[model samples]
Target: MSQEKPPVPSGRRRGGLLPNARDIKAWEEGGGRGLRGFLRRTIRAYLRWNRALLLDPWIRYRPAVQLLEGQTGDLQRTLDVGSGENGLARFLGREVVGVDLDFPATVRWSNHPATLLRAIRATATALPFRDGAFDTVVSMDMIEHLPTGERPKALREMLRVARRTAIVGFPYGRRSREFDRSALAVERDRGIELGWRQEHVLRGTPGEEFHDEIIRTVGAVRPEMTLSWFGHEGMRGLRLRWRLQFLISKDSRLYGLVFFPLYRLHSRGRPKHGYRRIYVFKKAAGGKPGDRVRRPARNSVRDPD
Candidate 1:
């Protein structure tokens, strides 16, 4: 079967202040300015603060506890690569180490920045830890942002560092062409040229005012298939409010808040091709002949390479 292609742009419009440049500089220096910089900082802060009230209590506290009920026989050390300011360590208890290049402004743990919750600036490709130092390693929604070519080395590093298990998750699947047609129509009618253009950021020219990220209202994730499906609505012709009724209705809110634990209970340890997915790998103990291993031959831009 042919692999389904996700709708992520192949080449982001490049020019003044590329995405990687901003991220790398911010990662190393921890300082950035301008509206974009402020937006990034603000988003980081919001994610950190909402970690406890929204993410932790809902997914980390109860669902994880129940899912790992029998499997927690011997979990001493857990490491979270790219933990960011999510407060995953606090919810995972003291044994967990939350590693990230940048530390959050605030954390829930009473202990100061110590050995367990060390916040070191490090890259995924070159992790600064000993082999087999962690029992479990986990990363969520992080792999996609990495350069198209660097994922395999990073995956190998995650596998190398973890003795027991590793779990990785990210978004997948294509954007619906149906949605695009309607969306682009609106821009045409308004005399606005929408979508990405290469010349928008030519050298010596001021940056264009075109929007970078255009969100299609019809896209959604099917957790079972890990498929991000788009709708028939094109860019100009979408009935945005009416079509997104499911998301805005009280039913969705209630189901999300009240029935989330039930969803977690049913979905644990069951790997489905969702519009997003969490991939898990377990390391075999001792020199087992049947154990599977992988190494990189070259740096390339292949998915799951």
Candidate 2:
């Protein structure tokens, strides 16, 4: 006796991932056919997609945005060190330039939501620029990725290039390090080993000493510039939220879908304990904004600010 095929699940193909052929056929035969139906579906899908694109950045960069925008005038001349995939240009404006040693010649901006980023291949420690080359230079969540010795050099380079300000934001203190460790554990439990996470876990997050060092380094490099820092995103329930994002996997669209809204909702509070900190170093005076700061000479002389 021949056996009958099992019924397919609703809206799903039998033994496959596509929509059920029978259901699609039925819909085409009904009111779901023709130009009117196609237009309706297209508009709906576009709206949903637009919403997702609007929320494409990670929550980690929100404070960076606040700090940059906090300054007077437009962010017309800004340099982003260790810019990676985060589209800081989109938030700040097209005038923003992102430089990173990791960017391959063929590589462009990260597949971020608002992608107006302009990227260049350059090392942070030996930034190919003259002193006070930009109005503002910022490196967000990137210091921890540098080798311990290179961190000071990178910070000095940033200070040297920036005419008025240099900002460094990164996960800070023992709690921040522990938080990253716990999140890495979540990834390991699920057999997920992302390269970025591996580097972050192995390199170690900046702790109390790192914070103090940044202060002392600022004093040494640019004594006239004022240094101020504040911690953000308290630990309570942060792990659970991070665990969900890790399980979803940062490579997935589902992760992008929740990123901005989570930042918008989660960042409004005043939390005593935080997983990250932002340090803003503003020069006492000097310089004007530009559409594009001249890229330094190929063999430009480098110096401390």
Candidate 3:
């Protein structure tokens, strides 16, 4: 008799490592399929948003929509550091460039060049590009993967390379040395590190020293900037439009059927608690070039008691 699959725990998100051999095989084959799926879904979403914008005039200045539109601007040259899979790179105009630690040469970008250069491997402390090599540089949701000590250096390099704009996106909730406390406990108890030998466990609390550090680093570089936050519903609304397009058009059978809704709904967004934080910075145009300001001598300044 065949064995029944175990039930996924209630409230545990789907695709969180509980899959059969068949599922794994399917996913491995579906990696390329998934990328195409997201591209289709995102394009569909853009169309949907376009419709909604036409229908509802009030949303013309919505922060989320505004941010999405901001990503579509004409950039002569862009460097997407830590660009995983180059999704955003596709949206950039013809002059864009991409660099990543893991992308292989086999990876293709028809419009522009995508280079595989590990930020860490190239020189974790210094970037490989000449000064002001790009009009825009973006690092999306990438800083947390770095060692805590190295993040500031990376941010500085990002600032140094961009001529006009630099944006960095990451989870906003907290900056903790131990971002996943319970997960670490599980790893230690199991005597397995998953892949890495160690992992962070403690969540960074609000008003922590790290927040000040990030503010200092980014503020010194891009003093005039904006912050945008997106929740699960916000992302879902974007993806639902994409799904509608796939359903209506039925362009690619495999893509329309399995990939469209799968990406539309599942790729919706992270948990409510795990929403992403986006920071957008535009370099000052012939603006004041002031001296580099160092962060305070202490992690954070304290008022006298």
lDDT of each candidate versus the true structure: 0.45, 0.66, 0.48
Model 2 agreement with the true structure over 1-305: per-residue lDDT tens digits: 89997765477645674344454444445446587478446544533453445332445666667777756664468888887655477566555778987754454433444556668778989888889888888887788888887887888889889888777777776777777787788778989786776777788877766766776776677777776666667776466567566566544434544554665676765344567777787765442222222222431232111
Q: What is the lDDT of candidate 1?
A: 0.45
The Cα RMSD in angstroms, rounded to one decimal, for candidate 3 relative to the true structure is 13.9
TM-score of each: 0.46, 0.71, 0.48
Q: List runs of model 2 lying over 4 Å from the truth.
A: 1-57, 70-75, 104-115, 246-260, 285-305
Per-residue lDDT tens digits for candidate 1, residues 59-147, read 42333333334456566677778776553455555556766667767554544354346566788888888987787777765555565
Cα RMSD (Å) between model 1 and the true structure?
Answer: 21.2
Candidate number of the best TM-score: 2
How much does candidate 3 score in TM-score? 0.48
Task: Give the winner by lDDT.
Answer: 2
Task: Look at candidate 3 and give me any clashing residue pairs.
Answer: 101-118, 164-283, 178-202, 180-201, 181-201
Model 2, poorest ten-residue lDDT window? 287-296
The per-residue C-alpha lDDT of model 2 at residue 274 equals: 67
Instruction: Sort the candidates on lDDT, descending order.
Output: 2, 3, 1
Q: How many residue pairs clash in each candidate at the backbone level?
A: 19, 0, 5
Ranking by TM-score: 2, 3, 1
Error of 3 at 3 (Å): 46
